[model samples]
Target chain A: MSTRTPGTDDGSAPLLTLLPSTPGGAAAPAPERADAARNRRRILDAAARIVAEKGPDAVTMNQVAHASGIGVGTVYRRFGDVSQLLWALLDDRERQFQEAYMSGPPPLGPGAPADERLDAFLDALVDRVAEQRALLLAAHSAAPRARYHSGAYQVMHTHVAMLVSRLRPDADPALLAHLLLAPFSPDLMHHLSVEQALPAERVKAGVRELLALRDRPRPA
Target chain B: MSTRTPGTDDGSAPLLTLLPSTPGGAAAPAPERADAARNRRRILDAAARIVAEKGPDAVTMNQVAHASGIGVGTVYRRFGDVSQLLWALLDDRERQFQEAYMSGPPPLGPGAPADERLDAFLDALVDRVAEQRALLLAAHSAAPRARYHSGAYQVMHTHVAMLVSRLRPDADPALLAHLLLAPFSPDLMHHLSVEQALPAERVKAGVRELLALRDRPRPA
Candidate 1:
């Protein structure tokens, strides 16, 4: 197996580093000029609002520029294109989510048993995917294979693997984590939530049921 | 929720019916001329050989035609393009696999317990994916989300769901089947076996370990 971390090898640093806060909630490597940072924040915030209101397909550079009261050229300059802007929006949300899971509180973060934490994380993941379903499905469609190597997926895998290691010391935690996380793929989730019209609550419950399968007796 | 069987609703009848044996091992709806059937078998065999030796990328119309001793124009006339030919190959292999799990004797088919059948199906599935890794990856790249709705996926889902329903009467078998099948997605399997360089036996063992989780006691 490659010693390199899963997502670090992928060329996502440029996009990941665009925001002020890193995914680990570490300090920025270098402080951006206050005004430039403000413009970036404004632009990303505007784009996020547009995505929330009308879905990612409805987002446009002009609309974000107008919404943020920034020039269209500035929006173009900062994010390069609509795709990059949307990715930045995803990165932004991802950073916050990482913070919450890594350190925010009990269960999802710290101060809880590994099993409870695993449950909390999977539940939160369903919500996280739901919150950004449109963007995630778009990103997944754009590069299906990239998900396994992407920064976000790597982090999730590492975290889940850690919990599995603690909970089931005898199992292969890394491989098990990957399998556990498979059910949360954006495409599968989209089929369950949008195409099948399954409620998020039901989906979450189903996740718990899968976890509960651990307790079932082996078939004789 | 959809009253339809998963694979039947997908528009795969034309490609699937191209072969004499239906996925169910039932008689073909219509028979082809003897020479045409012979030609079709020759073409597919030649293509499969090329793919096995040189991978899907090396397959070409002229190459298959030359190898099969069929006219290039006939190859194109029967299968419109390289992409269609690949899909036909996949459908062909899928038909055989479907027969094995659906009707073939013993653990994978009719004679074993539901849990053992599920395990056999998953192990066989891992081999099936590995056998067609390059072709499956190419098809997946062409359309990622389509996997959920594809005829092959639907059939696998239906079969797995049936096993789950038999084993866990209290669980939502349909949803659990989808989740269990999620780990076998082509892209992820490619990542594991090709990129990660994990052996097929190891992957199979990992899958068995995942299923074994059902027998593990719940965490306190």
Candidate 2:
């Protein structure tokens, strides 16, 4: 349910994450199983707090269990290991982000013109990457090439490709989409936002400005 | 002479290597020793052939030694290791490329308009990457993040940033340079060219088309 598969159920998203429930959220609430759903929230929340406060490297099963006021055995049984728990945390946040861009509201969602939608998407992407900086960096470094093939990237690429076609029917939408998304790669975002110390607003603005070339005459 | 040092002469490029002696070939000749510069050329030529035909993964010191008809000990002494030899090959080609764009002729060099020069640079970059696909991919995967911090990248970024400033003085040239160069990333090119089987010309054309939005009035 919590795997990285995109465009699927996103595993009953917003069932218990921090995102304000959206239109596409709350897909026919599944019947409660033996796993305690409330306990899952508590555990995930505790792990997220640990990641935010001390970074992912600091999170341990014992710490998460203690922070959640749950037994260590339950933590182990639920997540299997610290890495899995960290991935779960990333998935949780990604699901929320998908909801916002896919169906949350105007500009970001379905109602705005393609140009504003593109702008809104880039802005939201900056915030999303900034919000999950530590987790994304770790994921990126672990499998740097995997970013091009990841579910999140594919979903974002497909979304961007559609918008590029809408914005410029004469352009090569597929390649242009990849070029547009290039700046948002986790490593670049991490470099600009953290290494270079540019604020999220400036980063967002810079990314948007890159698209300002969309209607110029291309050199032959 | 090149060892991947970021921004520090890239270690006096082309003291010895095999590149076609073109119009932009050869900086001021450096002081030479008794060991014929011809010998350095032979060794590098052998390495390049192996890399092209068998891929960089198949390269070895002994193989280069045998292929170059040089002593195995000399190969070790000259390159320090297999990785260093591969880098020398990359730098050899990179130096030629830098020479072409920085001082060779019209569009890619100094004579053309900024916009056309920008297009030429990217076109040549595509050709450069296509020529050294195997080598670049190896170097990139080995140290993916190093691209941002490398001397070659810094030099390229400087060139692109200057062009961007010329084209749009009011724009954020520094950041736009990074965004513009992002599509040339080794990983993405490897994905598109090798993995996706995209023709080099199409990839080059698609990349140039992305800049079509350059002079358009951005949406307020």
Candidate 3:
């Protein structure tokens, strides 16, 4: 993990900062020392692992502290509570995802063709949502429409719209991108992956097929 | 409006029946008399108008009764309460929509080619969701994931999947249909139509553009 400042690392800084806003309207804290950043990373990783194994509802501060081998007081001090901690985890994952698709590497990041990058980004999105399904679902349930309003969704929409504009200059990339990303909503993902018991690979392939739908000629 | 039996009017019987299940498991009521059916229609029509003019939150039994020009007792007797009444309105509209798409005409119905039918169906779906945006959003908020499990969604999904299968025999039509339908989710529709204030026609066009995405040649 790069130990850079949380929201300022990339062009997505504005939206990323909206993810884990400080409670009580406190002024932004001073920059984290290297050790504090490392601790934050460890706490978050441990929390994510717990969420992966148990589910978001099962995450308690005590369990997170125990799992991270950090003091519970420090965990509480850093995160304030489980809800805030979970948001932080979500923000953390989203930042990493933003970094990957924004500038980290080719295909998902910068160098690949627009179509290839679009495919890569969507495929990676499927994995990202699946990896954090429970947490995402929990957050989604709290406010369903808020998903579209969130900074994360805006960033994803922006990225997808950029690629879509390149692929189909004649099309409305902004609206098309929203429609394209609609399938990856956490509730739908849960229904497909958990309720219908579909494999993630199958979901990714279906998304690709939807993308490649125009590749086939319309019947006469 | 056809005064046909609520769930038995078409092949969507099973799913349609799931919509307006009685609050208490008091065995299914007997078929309505002609006058009773007419009154039910009036009540539902009145409620739908209120929902359209104001919003679902503004619907009240007394208001519906007054709008339908029927006694409040009759409205209560037929529809039970505001919640059940809203659902019946949804069911009533869905039945009409289902009838239109299933066997009513050429394009959204059966006579047109599968691709045209697919386009027509999605276009109609945009209208359908927009018309019932408030009620559908409330239903979705009540249980976000229950959408996939709902009879209405299932029927729509089945229809879309069939069209997709006819359009692309090699594709996984079921999965594609689900993904294709995702953009029409009530929350997203609410965001687009209400929040973003994009006209329904624009949304419909964007949907069509998404459908036509494959028409363009891929960049070399």
Candidate 4:
């Protein structure tokens, strides 16, 4: 792996930060050191491949070390264990996605109207879950109840609740947010996108339709 | 238990019956043996009270035995295990709910417009799940994936799909059915009803609002 930080790298230690006050919105801190960032990258790349080829349960420190051509000692030092390594991998993508919505651009970010932003967020969510179906589903089923407790879920819930509050100030935004997020559950999405072979676009359209009926009856 | 068969009893074995080709409807066969039904009633009544007072996890043969005033040996002989007893409890309610929708009367049954019936069905579902929230949540978390595979889920899916097809012949009834049912997942309902403390009436209203938007836009 290159010892130099990638040009795109801003060096933010996004993963080390726990429980954001604003969840995904205002969370990234200053970047990690160049060598450390590169080591993390090398290790994650190897682990991702192993997860793809063998599955999350099959990933191990030794396998990732052999694949990355990195020292096994360094791998152990970086991730501490296979489970931490897998979470590191999830966190990497999670931060970027959070960044995209929290501050990246209009519609998905802060510049657009609430309804448009909500639509953009749901659309992006379809793609996000689609990107990591197996890994997320396994994680979710392992502790289905923990979905409500996780920092990631809280962040998403906070973000969604904020949007709903803006969209319908008179509505019970907290409950509405949960209702809206229900269809996005990994198990349900697995049934839709994977088992049913629905195109992501159709799922996105269906979600839009589902949300449209939330606060009002259908228009004639 | 009284050995005399009730006049309504038709001598069919309900417990030994397996998966029906059509899920819930047409699955009852004939009425259960009266003495066996009475025994089941006592066992389940005892189990329900224990579940309500403590929780499904707290249920045991001895507690059910003490509450039902039946022998512990009989509880084990009848239900085999706590888990099995809980399922039998669910199935008892499931059969009655199915009967109401399948052959009972107007709106929820046969004589009303499909849309009206759909509305009534969704409303009743809120009540049905709310009735046994703790028991259902325990059973559901134990096998989250199995929700889609269970005979109960299939029966509900079949019923919903039939209604969707009636309401929108050109739409993908099967997929729409799954999408509509996603929110009713026991975990989500628990989060909404128990954790958030939203009342069953509010949940029922919210579901009606949700289904009202099935394929239509919100009324201005």
* Backbone clash total, candidate 2: 9
Off by over 4 Å in 2: A1-35, A218-220, B1-30, B213-215, B218-220
Error of 1 at B95 (Å): 0.6
Over A96-189, each residue of candidate 3 has an lDDT whose tens digit, in order, gives: 8988999988988999999889989999999999988887887787678788877788889999999989988878898999999999999999
C-alpha lDDT score of every prediction, in listed order: 0.77, 0.74, 0.79, 0.73
Model 1 interface DockQ = 0.34
Q: What clash pairs does model 1 have?
A: none
What number of backbone clashes does candidate 1 have, counting pairs of residues 3 or more apart or in separate chains?
0
TM-score for candidate 2: 0.83
| Pick by lDDT: 3 or 4, better one | 3
Q: For model 1, state the Cα shift of residue A93 in Å.
A: 0.7
Query: What is the DockQ score, from 0 to 1, of model 4?
Result: 0.30
Span of 10 residues, lowest total lDDT, candidate 4 chain B: B7-16
Candidate 4 lDDT, tens digit per residue, B131-167?
Answer: 8888778777776777777788888889988987887
- For model 2, what is the alpha-carbon lDDT of residue A207? 74
Interface quality of candidate 2 as DockQ: 0.41
lDDT (C-alpha) at residue A60 in model 4: 63
Q: Say which docking band candidate 3 falls in.
A: acceptable
lDDT of 2 by residue, B1-220 (tens): 1123322222233322322122123353476675757777889999999888877766677777778999877877777766667777887888888888889998999999998898899999988888888777766666566678766777788999999898888778998888788888888888888888988889888877677633467458
Q: Which ten residues in a row have the lowest lDDT in candidate 3 chain B?
A: B7-16
**Position B201, candidate 3: lDDT:** 85
Candidate 1 scores a C-alpha RMSD against the true structure in Å of 10.2
